[model samples]
Target: MRIYKVGGAVRDRLLGIPVTDIDWVVVGATTEEMLAKGFRPVGADFPVFLHPKSGEEYALARTERKSGRGYGGFTFHASPEVTLEEDLIRRDLTINAMAEDDQQNLIDPYHGQRDLEARLLRHVSPAFAEDPLRVLRVARFAARYAALGFTVAPETLELMRQLSESGELEALTPERSWKEISRALMEDQPQVFIEVLRACGALKVLMPEVDALFGVPQPPAHHPEIDTGAHTLSVLEQAALHKQPLTVRWACLLHDLGKGLTPEEEWPRHIAHEFKGLKLIKAVNERFKAPRDCQELAMLVGEYHTHGHRALELKPSTLLELLQSFDVYRRPQRFEEFIAACEMDARGREGLEERSYPQADYLRGASTAARTVAVQPLLEKGFKGPELGEAIKRERLKALKAYKEQV
Candidate 1:
């Protein structure tokens, strides 16, 4: 049996980009033959195996017939008749459809090489429509390859539009959809994903809430450049510029999503836009199948919009109070999550507001407290168990009362 390196690794290798995953396709290997040859068999429903020594994946030369919808609903055949070409034909984009044999000779049954050279992404075959998840994949690829000057083939875009309008994308589990979106969010120019989805008419299919951000007008005094959509894109660009983690970046993108739902009555009434923003974050996460921690990050951005800087400024007594306000002791990691997201949130909106958010001023005052007791470790202070508990409670309450009096 002949083994061929396939998909993204080949594409990345050709592009002189660093590749992380190595996928291989084999011709003339049956499932039993693979197992007999010391490959640790996995994927019973489909035909995939792990190479014993190399630990790299070596999938059987298999073919698929579309049966249902989304990504999972398919019937695969790994018989002697299946050719390597048949496997690549079902791939979403031509760049990902190329393969390389053991001799390191690249295979290009489809003109994936031509498309990659041309900076284009087209489906391998008409079978692309069998799985709607390809639309999101293509959208992500558009963002990643945008610097390559790649464009989606017009036919592929048309097919995506048809699938979206027909709601074939709706069959996708929220988890699966977010898996693609989360990866897309990590891209350098992720706004392209949103734009591509909008072009394909799939944004409304998955994210109707934030999709409304488009064309939503902003007042002339603060934002004369463009609508909320434009502003969000700018914010996303800025967030990307910071080289922050995906969670922080996502909060920046969604922090202003609530503005679209607010009435533009001259001054822009987003008094509790933070509150609305938090709910939308949860909704978006649920709709897109985000993890609990991710959902919490989004919620914390909205819920703790006011108190980030306040934590830094308080007297040790007052600092305890502010920490208590967030109920931090029981949820340390989550509270820290809120702090990180709030920093991103403020940074995203700071320029547009062009004025100090409440937290900014509070943070300025907080530096003094940091100078004093910042190094005092509570664990080393001879406090343990419920005694540790009572001391903390006493200090926190005193801080809260003192902080309120100062305000």
Candidate 2:
């Protein structure tokens, strides 16, 4: 059996990037042979194994045929007869189809290296259209390599558009879809992921709430970027620039969904859109089966981002209420993520990228002051049960009030 380093390890190495993981393809090897050699079988749907020593994944060279529908509807064939070239041809992108042999020889059967130099994301073969999940994978690759000036090949984009129109994107499981989406959000140019999906019309199918924001008007006075969808992308861009975590980035993406639900006659003004967005966020969370932390932060940002923006104007009691609503004492990190999401919204407007968002610091200070209100003192004074809870709230409110006066 001949083993070759394949997929992302070879792709990243060719791109002058740090290779994070190594995947091996064992050609002319059967599952029985692999097991005999002490390679632990791990792939339930296909023949994949962990190496006996290094513990790296070593998948037997396999070929697949479209059997039914969606991404998982595939029949895989792995045997001593399957060629390494056949296995490479089934990859999603050209750049990822290349492989490196033990002798350091580059395999370029599909011209992957050429496309890599061209900074293009091209499909390995026409078979790419068979898997709807490739749409998200392509967009995610676009997001990851956007800073490197990569663009999807025009023919590849047409295929993606065709896939989006095929009604197959809806068949993907929520868990699988969210896996791609959440990883894309953590990429360097996550907004590009959304842009690519929208370009191919997959966003409308995958995330209609986000798609509805397109062409919706917003007040030009506050959002020089006018279009709600454009504003959302801008906010996501700012989140990337600030290196905000996935929770903050996700919150920024959904924070404006309610603006799309506003009446046309109301035009650029959206009254109580914050409350309206809560439902949209819930729908998104439910559909995607998003992580609890991500869903919680998105919901908080949706319902109270405006309050965060108006922190300086809120009464001390109101500020205390907001802090308590976020449960800052128990989950302070999520509150900080909420503030980051709000800051991204504030700075996402055209020409306002560098503008100050003192609201973030204000809320952070308020949280700090509220947290310092010493529940121990109340307990020591013989306050018990619900009475202790009431005393703690009273002291926190009073401390916040005093801090507000000092400010």
Candidate with maximal TM-score: 2
TM accuracy, model 1? 0.82
lDDT of 1 by residue, 50-114 (tens): 99999999888878887887778898888767788888887888899999877878889889999
Residue-level lDDT of model 2, residues 260-321, one tens digit each, is 89999998899999998889999999999999999999999999999999999999889988
Lowest-lDDT window of 10 residues in candidate 2? 372-381
Output the TM-score of candidate 2: 0.98
For all candidates, the clash counts are: 4, 0
Candidate 2, position 393, lDDT: 88
TM-score of each: 0.82, 0.98
- C-alpha local distance difference test of each model: 0.74, 0.93
Off by over 4 Å in 1: 224-226, 264-268, 306-407
